[model samples]
Target: MGAPLSAWPWENLGIFKYMLYGPFVGRVMYEIFYEEEKDWKFSWCLQLLILSAVRGLVYLFWNCYTNSLFLTRNRQILKQGVDFKQIDKEWDWDNFLILQTIFASMAYYMFPFLQNLPTWNSKGVIAALIFHVGISEPLYYWVHKKFHGDYLFTNYHSLHHSSPVPQSLTAGHGTVLEHMFLSLVIGIPILGASLMGYGSISMIYGYILIFDFLRSLGHCNVEFIPHNLFETFPFMRYIMYTPTYHTLHHTEKDCNFCLFMPLFDALGNTLSSKSWELHKSYSAGNDSRVPEFVFLAHIVDITSAMHGQCCLRTFASLPFRTRFFLIPFFPFAVIGVSAMWLWSKTFLFSFYYLRDRLHQTWVVPRCGFMYFLPFATEGINKHIEQAILTADKIGVKVISLAALNKNESLNGGGKLFVDKHPNLRVRVVHGNTLTAAVILDEIPKDATEVFLTGATSKLGRAIALYLCQKKVKVLMLTLSTERFEKVQKEAPLEYQSYLVQVTKYQAAQHCKTWIVGKWITPREQNWAPRGTHFHQFVVPPIFAFRRDCTYGDLAAMRLPKDVEGLGCCEYTMDRGVVHACHAGGIVHMLEGWTHHEVGAIDVDRIDVVWKAAMKHDLRPLSSGSTIKAN
Candidate 1:
């Protein structure tokens, strides 16, 4: 809810709200291509749009930079993470820029003195500064203070205050009326300069760009401003507000109301006593909390690399997919790959809190295709090893290897690390034990026999052994007779007959339960009976080719209800849900387990880990499939 007229008309338009500039842009295009002599106003309008885009890039740069845990961990002012609400509220953050451009264009025609001008104006810069210091500062200060009062706070100002942990875009997130007033505040300097015959295009560009830069700096939530500078010149603190100063205003709500200067707050007696103190503490590198658990994941593909939390928030929040809008960003993805390969180290991807425990996802900086390259194995292993060593150095209790990070062929399900560092205090976990558990538990109790693919793989072997013990027949699909016979010999002598070896997909035609651990094509999928349910542990899950047969999502579990600040999804999983391996690592952390759960799946610990996961409130998916199959 907001005050009357506070909301923009296109608030519900999403990305299409930018269409408001279409008419102006179309006119500009007409002037460039169709007209012999361009109207100065059209050129100015085009410049304003271009400047707005540049400022937009400025904001995006800060947002991505501040979101990186590797870069801004110690300088982060707020420990609480941003949620979807903040992301939604700031979606139309550039609305004010568009409004100002439109209003400025209208004013160009309305005022006779504001016609064409030169590119640069030195005198105009001085006049703009005077107008800003003498007028805009005082005007914004008083108006901002007034907005904090009861009625205004509820209807209008509360929208800006809604985000306690501000980002670069938070500077522009407010009601339309607030933005209108801001336009006036911004306009006074330029309008005053124009009246005095000192206005020029450069004056407008410099002043507005500086204004946006300061606003972004204050709200970026990273305290990069050094305290020593304020110590050297104490007066500078009154002239400029740091990220910490603005953070105080958001958190405390009654003080530090000035736009980009604290001098007004000092004069008005609203300056918080703790503002400078908190800033000093943050800038001095005080907030350095170590994560309790880490999930060491690697990039899946080039397309999936674009789904990084810091790269594209909206895309990362949903299931991973090939999107039309992502086409323009393909070059960026390629650059990211090249940059990572050149730099080549583990980096923080995302993080959240669960029951006061911090859990972070760290990427191994290699894509799935790169992992398959024979020459890339050593580099991948080195990155993974460095991450493990770093976690151990930082006192992280548990670190889980995810997806390809724990591939049997690559590192023997993370066994290589555990063996290399025998003195390691940090537990190395593959999390496949719980993955096997989740897949087995998803099968209906009435299921008597199951057809298995990738039957010789790590998870496949565990599932087959477990099911055979329960007298459930397992049709192991593998071409290697030696591997099949070895697995059969491991099963109890009495239950050995339950583990049957069938080398082809056609053998599973009579079976209704098909457990897939390998990617199957649509041609191979046709072998499943109409009612067959494909419970899978395959990466890039098998396609749902049959309308009559249901397909379960890759083994996953819903996070506990008490988990905090989980604003993004994990790969293709739904909100607040994670792959079973991720949950398994979390379970390991929560249970205070000390064993390194790597190498091979311990059949005895599968039920133990599953029970512990359930005890800690992690749950198996109720439906399995995102969409139903009849």
Candidate 2:
């Protein structure tokens, strides 16, 4: 009977009320000290410090909570897969705390110098905020530009740039000099306003809280700003900055230098080129429940001899449509070919689920072989389109065109696919970039001359151009002299001296390094010299047996490891290698790069592939002395 059930002990003591109105505790203390006739300046100073400390504590807790919420809420869009509980070794929290304390003390020391104590009223508070923002933007921009100078950047500013993936806590994580500069940038505006008699103690504390919140928001990895808000009010984008804008400053390093507002960046022309597109695309909160998955689609022709023969024998009794329907039931037929009638068709063969440790997700690579031959351009195009449609049904993120697929779909280097298949979310890549990279990297440094077959083809043309740039003597072999001369005329003026167009295979024998650009028959392999290093770039790789001869493939050299189903010629040194085109799809999946990487290879992309391979500890499978087909 001491207390009713509705009136709890904690409520009767007013603990809940005190907690709810904790910020007003400073006001209560100020009033109590005023009654005692304490020194007004000392009492005001104590109240200001208390209020500032309370706001700072509240912001810190709010930052932690909001960051956790955003990370959990938009896990898929952020896609960092980082554990917030695990502190990074690079974060110097001890130094951060010490520097913050020093800045706080400095701000407190400077407080007495200001003539006007800040007014606690709403109008004064609003006026002070406007002044603070107006002054801080330009001051921060110039100081930031100075910090980016060579001397300061190398010694101090580079510490902040170390975080490629930033978080809320990283907002102030930098060297002592950097932190001092940043604190000055935040502090000067408030001090200037107070000196002008526009700011009050409450205004100073309020501005600091808002400043910290905005800075924290900029550093947060999650893009929380609604894109439609900017669309509705275009000027709002100038007034506010998104997380992507700040992230671009870290990744690109040359743009988006403003602190809170993008006004300075727009004036300086320092905004990122892709900032608006990224903001619009990524700002919509992501589905957190969707588990990350990568898909790779490959094509294998059903017209190939090994698979075609088996397919014909198996489907001898079945009708055309019957064979098509039964194709999925027969695993061997699916892997190889269906029938001669369906040779113009493409079918998805094998599917792989590999754990990509880098992305912390499952990467699925599917092999879909087209039934059309290399030279069958019209038929190959029809099958390629069908293969893409089938891949779309499976919901593959990316489909890599291999060999003949590349040859048919080389219109603007797969840009045609992108234009034609807008509804299909799957991205098409030629996978030729890394193929060229592997070929270039493997060529013997001292070799003066290299033989390039099918020089008019896209891959061959790219290689020919790259080799010409390197000043290596290139023997360009093509079936048609007209096509050869056309390519020669198109070659750069400087490259003319190094390039030699040849019609015969005998001309290639003189060159020690042979690049097989087209599918070589058994007779064609014997044309190269005994000691020649044949770098095969074609699928279903062809090999020559000669005394002390070396055989390697462009695809084999770039593979992180020897995959079981990869097409390798019957040779010891280059066994267990997959097609370069197939490897390209796997590379895209493992790295989780969702873009069109088509046409001529980018040399930079090879470095990316090499780094990913090393990070994942991927290695070539054991190569036996004798080759065995999978």
Question: What is each predicted model's overall lDDT from 0 to 1?
Answer: 0.87, 0.57
Where model 2 places Cα greater than 4 Å from the true spot, the runs are 1-78, 83-86, 90-119, 286-630
What is the per-residue lDDT of model 2 for residues 214-268, given as tens digits with 9 covering 90 to 100?
Answer: 8777766677788999999999888899887788887778788898888898888
- Cα error, residue 514 of model 1, in Å, equals 0.6
What is the number of backbone collisions in each predicted candidate, taken in the order shown?
A: 0, 15
Q: Which candidate is the best by TM-score?
A: 1
Q: How high a TM-score does candidate 1 get?
A: 0.96
Q: List model 1 lDDT by residue over 1-630, tens digit each.
A: 546967887878888888988987887888888887766453866886888888787787777777777678778888767766667667678887778778888888888777776777799999999999999999999999889999888888898998868988888888888888999999999999989989998888889889888889999899999999999999999999999999999999999999998999999999999988888899998766999999998888888888876787656777787899899989999998788878877888788889999889899889898778889899899999999999999899999999999888899999999999999989999899999988888877767899999998999999999999887999999999999998899888999999999988999999999999989999999998898889999887888889999988888999988887676788888888999999999999999999999987998788899889888999888634321111
Q: lDDT of candidate 1?
A: 0.87
For model 1 the local lDDT of residue 4 reads 90
Task: Give the distance in Å from residue 526's predicted Cα in candidate 1 to where it truly belongs.
Answer: 1.3
